[model samples]
Each structure stands twice: as C-alpha cells, then as structure tokens.
Target: MDRDAEKIHHDDSISHSQREASSAASTTVFAADVGDRTTAEGPYPRLQDQKDDVPQQTSAPAPPSDTAPQRGKWQKAIIVVSLCAALFLAALDITIVTTALPTIAADLNSGAGYLWIGSAYLLTSAAFTPSWGKISDIWGRKPIVLLAAAIFFVGSTLAATSVNIAMLVAARAIQGVGGGGLVVLVNICISELVSMRDRGKYLGYVAIVWALASAIGPVLGGVFTARVSWRWCFYINLPITGVVFIVLYFMLHLDNPKTPMWDGLKAVDWLGTIAIVGGTLMLLLGLDLGGVSFSWSSATVVCLIVFGLFSAVLFVLVEWKFTKNPIMPLRIFKHISNSAALGVCFCHGYVFIAGSYYLPLYFQAVLGASPLLSGVYLLPYAVSFSVTSYATGLFIKKTGKYLPTVWFGISVMTLGFGLFIDLPSSPSWPRIVLYQLVAGFGVGQNLNSPLVALQAMVKPPDIATATATFFFTRVLSTSISVVIGGVIFQNEMERRYSYLRASLPEDVARGLTGSSAATSVGILAQLPDDQLQIARNAFYESIRVMWIMYVAFAALGMVISVFIGSHILTKEHTVAKTGLKQERPVAEPTEQERA
Candidate 1:
C-alpha cells in the first residue's frame, strides 16, 4: 500500500512541473508578441524589459490591436483631406498678406506701423511653436489642434473687424499663436497615424498643399485687395477653419494617455520656456530692425543682440541642468544623426528663403516685371517643388532609405545656386524658369526628408518635440537669412549707386540710391531710360551677390548632410537602437506554489 501511494504522488508532482513549464513558455511567447507589436505599430517606443515574466508600461499608449477595426480607404481619404485643408489655411495666412499689406496700410493709415502687421505675427509664431508642441504632447493632439483652430478662427474674426492698426496687429499676433501650433501638431498627428515607412507619402501630400498655398497666396491676396477688400484675407480663414474643425471632430480619433493635471503642470519647463521665448524674440527683433529700422551699431540693436545671446545661453543651461522636462531636450543632440540633420535643415532654410525672397526681387527690380507677373514667374518653382516632393516621398517609401536622396537633393541645389551666378542682365524667360526648376526640384527632394530622418532617430514620444525644434531652427534661419540677404543686397546697391553717382545727374543718383529703387519695380520704371538701365545693372549685380551667398549655404548643407548617420528606416516604431537598456521586474513564485 505504501509503495503504490509513493508512485501516485511522484506522477502528480511530474504533472504539476510539466504544467508550470508550459505556462512559462506561453508567457514568454506572449511577451515576445507584445514586443513585436510595440515596435511594429506603436507610435512610441516599446519598453524593453530584460527580466523574464516581467510587466512593463510603455511611454505612449499601447498600439491598437491588429484585430481592431482598420480604417477603410475612404475614411483615410477624408482624414487626409481634412489635414490638408487645415495646413493650407495656415500656410496661406503667411504669404497671403504680402500683397494685401499695401491695401491694409492705406485702409488703416498705419504708416510706419505697417511693418508691425507682419512682424507681430512672425514673432509670436516663432516664439510659441515649441511651447505649443510640448503642451500637445502632455494634453493630447486632437484637443490641442481643435483649440488652435478655434483660436485661429477668433483671431481671423478680430482681424476682419479691427478698426485700427493696433487692433489688427494684436489680432495677427493672436492668429500667429494658433498658426504655430497647427503646423507642429499636424505633423505629429500624421506621424502617429502612419507607419514610418509609409509616412513620407503622406508628408509629400502635405508638402503639395503647402506649395500650392504658397504659390496661390499672393495671387489671392492681390485679387482680394483689388476686387474685394483686404479684410477678406483674414475673413477667408474662418470658413476654411470651420470646415476643417468639423471634419476633424468627426474623423480624427486618437488614444491620448491620461496623466494627472498637477503632474502635467509640473512636467513643463516654465523657466526654459520663458528663456527661449525671450531669447528668440530679442534675436529676431534685433535682426529685423538692424538695417531696416535701426543701424547695426545703434544701442537698441546692440543691446538686443547681446541680450538675446545671453538669454540663449541661459536657456541651454536650464535645459541641460535645471529642468527635469526640457522644452528642447539636450539629449536629442547626442545622436549624430539628429545634430547633422538639424544643421542641414538650418542651412537649407537659409538658402531656400534667400532664393524665395530674392528671386522675386530679381524678377521685379532687374527684369522689370509687374508684381502680378513676378508671382506668375514663380510658377516653375512651385510646380517642380510639388512634383519632386511627391516623387522623393514615393521613392523613400519604396526603399526605406533617405540619406542618399537627401545628399542628391542638396547636391542638385548647390549646382542650381552655382548656376544662378551666370544669370544675364536680360535673360530669356526660359533660362530663368529652367534655373528655378532645377532648384525647385532639388528643394523638393529633401524638404521632407529631414523630418523623416529625425522621426526615425528618436523614440516615438519625442516626435513632437523634435519636430518643433526642427521648425524653430528653420524659422529662425529663415528670418536671419532674409535679413542677411537684405543687408547684402542693400549694401551692394548702395555701393554701386555711389560709384555711379559721380557721373549721373544729382536727382537721378539720389533717386537710385533711395530704398524704393531696390524694392519697387514701379519706381524703377519711372526712371529715365539711361538711369533705368544703370539701376537694373546695379540690381543685377546685387542679386548675383545674393545668389553667390546662397551657393555657399547650399554647399554647406550638402557637406553637413554627409555626416547624417545612416539608419535602416524601420517600419517598426521602436526606440532607436542606441544601446540603451530597459529595466523590468522578474516574476516570483508564490510560497505555496514553490512548496
């Protein structure tokens, strides 16, 4: 009887051990599957626990289950359309006011204050972008985007109804706050919805909307100013924004992580925000005012430059040491890929903006085209940019590589800018258009690649912050480039005019030296034929200098792009394989189970 009992007991013990082994194996498989899904589908990086049978929480919400209802083609189409419309509205607002400025100045009798109409919007937008990005990460994307649209709508209404220039400037600043957020959040939202591999195609579509808006904005502004009222420029945003808001409300669905309000508040780097905003404002103010409103040596400009530099330094320190949650995380710069990509982005902005701003000057001041005709002449750039952007996106989607494409784009841009130096005093339309097309194609190739490369380098949670930094750098570079280009052009024109002044009539020399001679084709047209020819020659030489500067910038971009670390663009949204380890607890057996 005792031997039989022992045999049964041993058999039961063996059965229990087998059951435990099977359960452990199944758990290991479950964890592996979860990890795969996290990398393959999650917007943020998956927590990688080293211990067996340990549970980990992801920084971002878990990705939707594969079995979850997938969005149909039509549903995705609606979402894309809605996003594009919102993007168009934001981009249009930036340039649409260019032609309307004169009408606005006349209607409001703004005089010198007219400059503030554009300055206020730009200043507030640049300062507020990163902050808005951080906020979106903490709160949620959809709510913040809706809030931005609502703020933009209110600003538009106020702008349309403003009785004085002060009110209008105020309204524009308000609009800028919303506009800044819209641009950043839209990109983030798209990153969340699409896989990294497929993201470029959708980004290409966004680029199309942006390019179209940029091309059409001035034309629409002219129509409104001439046929309707300048107020329509502001009023038009209302209906578009309303439609976008409605569509977003219905179609956009995202799972936002919930954090306590106090925790969210504590997570913000308030000091860093203030320092950065103040620094950017001061820097931009100095750059904007240096040559136009005040001399570079003036006390106001000097003080602003110094203060801006000091604040910037302080901001870096705060981000590095003082803040627990940095507005611009210092660690992002640790990756060579990110640092190099940002450098390229800055140089790209400088070259692109310089081209955009100065090409029009060449058309109007040197070529003697009318304002409307000058805008029409820019069509080659817009169309080629759109085409190449879409094509490059498709190429990246297929190959899952971006660095080589970026290198090719920058090389082409450098070549194009180099060719601009050969522009004749009176070139044929085809010659100029072909030059612009080459540059535009180059611009399109890499315009969206930096963002893609940046997104790929970081974990998903950092997408918004990284994007905001990219944009802030680009914006800052553009503002500085425009100012620098203006300085170069103005100084060169003045120098050339001075040399020519020795032989010309006093009146003609003085007129040629005036600011209007460099900006207004109408003023150039009124000059005597002899004086007009001299003015055109002077403008041509100055524009050539600007192009040479652009060449240098484009070349720098190409060189910097070489240092961009190559990574296999993964379809999986995993943390960058940066050799960082994740910690997790190991499951322990209960005392009864052990016994």
Candidate 2:
C-alpha cells in the first residue's frame, strides 16, 4: 500500500480500539489523555504487546504527548466513593446484627438461646475470603465485586423477610460470603487504579467508609427495630447495594480479558486455603462453644478440641508441602515487614474487637441502656475511628508515608486497650464514653495501617494473594479473639457469679439468675435499676480480664510493628496480575537506609 494509505489504516485501527476503551470504563483510566512521547525512547517503559502476562494494557497507543494525563491523575473517583459505601455496608452487617439479635429471637419465637448469628457470618466470611480474593484476581475486581454486591443484597432481602431464627442465620451466612469479598477486594481496586504516591491521599476515603459504617449501623438498626421493624437494617443494604452495583456496571469493565489467568491463578495455594479454613473454623468453634453451651471438660468440648487440633495440624502440613499454587505464600513470612504487619494485626484485633463485643453487653446487661443508647454511647468511639482514619489519609497524603502516624496510632491504641483494665462495673456515663473513645481511636488507627503496609510492599499482580493473605490473618485473628474473649467472659462470669448467693448482699446479688449476666446493653434501657446494678458489677470485673487480654495483644502488635519490613522507598516496580496498579516503580525508598 502507498505511504498515505498505510497511515490511514493505522489511524483506523487506533480509533477502533479507542472506541472499545470508552465502551469499557471501570479501570482507573488516568483522567488525563495519554499524550505523545517526548523522549525518543519514551518516558514510561513500552508496555509489551504480549496479551496475556501484563496488567495495564495500552488502550489506544498512548495519546499524543500533550494529550496524555499526568501519571498520577485518574478517572474513577466517584466509583471509589460508591465502592467505599458498599464496603461500609458489608462490614457494618457484621456488628449491626449483634445488637438486633434479642429482638429477632423474641419475634421468631426462639428464646435468646442462639448466640450463633454473628459466628455464622464470621465463619462463612472467613471461609470464603481466600476464594473471593483469588476469584477477584482471576475475574477482575469489577465482575466479582458486582457479584458480591448482588449476593449481599439478596442476603439482605432474605433476612428482612425471614420468619425463623434458622433462616436469619442462614441468610446472614450468605451475606457474610459476599461481605467477605467486598471487604478483602476493595483494597485491590483502590491500589490498582490510583498511583502509589497518591494512594494515601485517596485512602482517607476508605477510612471514612469503615468508621462511618460502624457509627451509622447501630443507630439505623435501632430506629428500624423500634419504629419500622428489625428487618429494615437488612432491607437497607438492598437499595444501597443495588444502586452501587448499577453505577459500577456503567462505570467499570476492569477484568483485563487480556491478562493471562495463570499469573493470578497459577500460584494460588488451594491446599493452603483448605487447610487454613478448616483449621481456623474448628479452632474458632472450639473456642466459641467450649465453655458456654458445653463445659470444657464435656465430651462435646473434648471432641471439638480434638477436631480443632487435628485440623490445625493438617492445615500446616498441607500448606507446607502439597499445593502447586499455595494460597498463603510462606515466602511473605520471610519478609520482616509482612511478618511484623501481621503481628500488629493480631494484637490490633484483640484490643479493638474484644471491646466491640463486650462493651455492648456491658451497656445493655449491666447499665440497662437501650440498644440505641448503647450504639449512641459507642458513637464517639466509632466516629473517632472514621474521623481520624480519614484525617490519617490526608496526613499520609501530605506527609507521604503512613509510618510516623502508624507508630502514634499503635501507641494510642495500646494505651486505650490498657485503660479498660480499670473500668468499674458501675461507671458514670462520662467515664464510659471516655474509655470508649480512647479504645476506639486506637482500634481505628490499626484498621488501616497493616493494609497500607501490605499494599505498599507488593506488586499489583500479587496484590490479590497478598491482600487475601493479610486479611486472612487479620480476620482469623479477630475470630480467635472473639471466641477466646467470649470463653473468658463466660467462664469468669459463671465462676464468679456461681457462688454469688453466699458472698453478696441480699438485694444486690439477686440479678445473677440467667442470661443478663452474660450479655451486653448497647443502647440505654428502661429496665429496673436493681437488675442493672448487679449485672454492672459482674461485667466490670469480667471485662477487666478481657482488657488485660487486650493489653497483651496490643503490646504484641506493637512489637510486631517494630519488626515490620519498613522498606525504604525503592525505585523498583512489579505489575499486579490483577491490574490494580500500572507497571511502574512504586514509592521511592524511604530516605532512611535501614528500612
């Protein structure tokens, strides 16, 4: 063909591809156009045309240099905002239902005998997280994210209409699976599209989602339970999630069909996933039911103990040898920062969530606060997490790294957890709020730190695996904490209160007859005063040990942070198999050499 004819052909092909790009919108397309290359050699590396291995593929051969958007600028801020909301909904479900359980139990004609509602979701979410993360990596974040949204919405619909306790628990389990995906996968989306340098700046938006959801869930739940129905809390996720999913459909088409599946799926440690889940579930259940419904020495508890140990041993063995694509890359453990980050995660979970579960019990059972009041008193705590988290995002943006702030966050959380050690069962309102705020701030800071660290350390291709692994440890730790804390509280309360008739004053000791001593009061209540005081003193002592447990975990988390692999900003980069980040060198190594 003639020279002019050839030029025309090339132009036509390029235009066709650009049309394709516009039609498919979910990627964090740099908002700016891809301009001409100024350098004879080009500024960024030439992306290989090898269709299968790469993450970010050049859609229209980089627009003219002048037209190219700045490297850090991106197209999907609104999508992120919506996603943040979805994330909030998913996480909020975990805690919100706990507050509404008593109402549900009575309505369903089941005495408040089943405390398994929270566990059903927790276990299912934990079980499915690795699978969901891997699927998101394989299928791309958009499709799977949409799938999760659908699942959560359906689960909500199911729960809202349920007539039995069994159905409610089952519905929650379904939602938990979806919620698990949303929780673990959002990080992949955020890191993939946004520039690493700009991540911290944009990251605050995520912090807001976490904090606000916790704060809003209970209040909404209370209102729904009192006025509309307990079902509103579940129903609410439907419209909210449906709207986000529709918007996402129009805005995103991110599963780079061009990316080879092997890069993301090839190394997936399925055996590791199986082993981990089995071990984790067994262990969590053993801890959960051992001393509450069944005595620790009972045959049932013994069998559970045996099963848990066996599962753990099997899991470790499987992870150590069998799977071709190991889910939890043991190699990540070789990195000090990853290891330290996980350690911090363990302690962080212990300090924060331990308070989350028990404080409500204290409020409701001991203080006689209504569910709304409980959620309200806890408001400052949840809000602090959100406000500080968003502020931390801004801080990281302005300061350039999350390190200094992380240190401060850990220190504060540790102090906060320690404060609960002195809480008396019958505290004045101000004292309770003060302690709640302190613990909340500490817990809030922790929520984002390790996640940021993991993102900073890994490439986009490996982010799914890394993120799943990180959260796996995190959620797993939380499971263990909840189970263990429950056991401690149950056993201690039972042991302490078992002989209460003889030791206490006649009027004060009478309230120890049933479930009141074991539960939390989130909102302030209209209950009788005598019952409230008895429950309060019992809780004050019970929670003291739980806080003591928190102090230990927080200290452990801090120590882990000390050893975390703080990489000095480096000039190297790796492409995420999942298309989360562009193929570019990440942050410049920190100025300090030791990291």
The candidate 1 region of ten consecutive residues with least summed lDDT is 576-585
By TM-score, how accurate is candidate 1?
0.86
Each prediction's TM-score versus the true structure: 0.86, 0.76
Q: Could you give candidate 2's per-residue lDDT for residues 534-567 as a string of tens digits?
A: 4556666776776677788787777777665443
Tell me how far the alpha carbon of residue 67 in candidate 2 is from the true structure, in angstroms, after superposition: 16
Candidate 1 residue lDDT tens string, 323-400: 766778776676666888899989988887766777777888888888778788888887897899999989999998
Q: lDDT for every model?
A: 0.78, 0.66
Backbone clash numbers for all candidates listed? 0, 53
**Cand. 1 Cα-lDDT:** 0.78
Best by lDDT: 1
State the number of backbone clashes in model 1: 0
lDDT score of model 2?
0.66
